[model samples]
Target: MDISINYTRGQDDPKSGPVKVGWVVSDVEAPVIYDPPRRVNSRDARREHGKSASRCPAVLGLESRYFEIACPFDINIGFDRDKDGRPHLRNLAGTSGPIRASTLGKRLSITNEAEWRYPDRPIIQLKLPYIFLADEPTYITQLDAYLHYRKTPLPGTIFGGRFPINLWPRPLMWAFEWHDVSKPITLRRGDPLFYCQFEFDNPERSVQLIEASMTPELKSYLEHISSAVNYVNQTFSLFDAAKRVRPQTLITPARS
Candidate 1:
């Protein structure tokens, strides 16, 4: 199964490969240490290999199935406020070109119609520019992209949500939400940003990701309803709006 990747941002950079296939050596020129989101690790063997959780098929299967999505840059964001008493967020550090952090506008509000804003915790969107989809649409009957954030060090702070990219055709983007705003949010380059897994309805199926070119027909297919959400409030209410604009039936999206 090939999940077509459009490197809208980092074209050849190894950090934003989006699919973790193998370990990234420490030789890459950078400052902070890069810890790969490997499914299994070969470390110090304290006990004899008689029985262990790591050796179990069921246990290793879960990790092996998931493809890791790594952060492309070293980003440091700090919370701040102005004299006017309105709070705000500032990007302290982020480099290596392409990857960036931005404040999510009011159009994409957390609530339906901004009835209740995100409190003092200003929401920031990680601008990870990459698009993924089951472009082949044959070997994989249905593709579901799930992004989870439990493996990272910042567990309770940075939030994770599922994105049905097969139907949506949106790029790889991240929303940052902090539990306790006291400490700043930081993610070093090559850090595990999200644990991405391509799922199918049948449990016996497996998947592999590959970069593919975006066809003109596929581009039109994606453009049909890609920006439709911005025209409305609350994504749940976009069914009617989507039908009006959706012009193609590339792959029937099972879930989002």
Candidate 2:
């Protein structure tokens, strides 16, 4: 069945277009940032320094409710992979509603997308901050941003440094990059920091859900990526909170 996916700057418009996000990845070339060793504070004033003064800043130390599980009319359409890379069920009559790895294809292309679209609700309200980036202020229509938000980082890591002509190697500060969230543009959240809303169709046809996480490794990656974006944004232009408040710069000429 064909599904109409609509993204809106505001909830009222259905033809606003689907939201999009961007993600970039290249083998193992992404940079990685790590903190230097912690500085040992002197417990006693009269004693000599226990260690040398060279060190980096110590690592700055650092839901939700519910929703329905829709039962699709045809469970076979829900997922399409079995252990032998085959279909386990012929129809929805006898199959369970919950999606399992066994019922998914070998590649992890879009298993979760089907699950998000079963209800046909047309107005799904997601109470999570799943949005990562956007091209427009009112709505999002970039799939890359969404995908970047969903991307997962692999385990291994590496660091980078500069090399000078005079010296074999030069001192370079640490920076971090992720194979997953490559280069995110902007991330926003409400004051409560707990809840946001997503509207899905009651008779949901097609959509996707990507969970935001605070996993130690994921957090580190996000922090580095965000910091990098902030650095760029700051260098290019000041973050004008006023623009958000007063977007209209069109001023009328004063009457003499």
| Candidate 2, 1-256: lDDT as tens digits | 8796653245565524442221111112111211111112322334344453322122111011111111111122222346765322122323453434443222112323233333321111111112232122322111111111213332212122221111110112211222222222111221011111223323121222232223343333333333433346442242343233332311122232
Considering every candidate listed, which one attains the maximal lDDT? 1
| Total clashes in model 2, counting residue pairs 3 or more apart in sequence or in different chains | 35
Q: How do the predictions measure up, each by TM-score?
A: 0.59, 0.16
Residue 78 in model 2: shift from native, Å?
Answer: 39
lDDT per residue for candidate 1 within 48-93, as digits (tens), equals: 6657766667755765676555665566666666797655665665
TM-score, cand. 2: 0.16
The pairs that clash in candidate 1 are none
How many angstroms is residue 52 displaced in model 2 relative to the true structure, after the best TM-score fit?
A: 65
Q: What is the C-alpha lDDT of each candidate?
A: 0.47, 0.24
Q: What is the alpha-carbon RMSD of candidate 2 to the true structure?
A: 24.7
Query: How far out, in Å, is residue 87 in model 2?
Result: 50
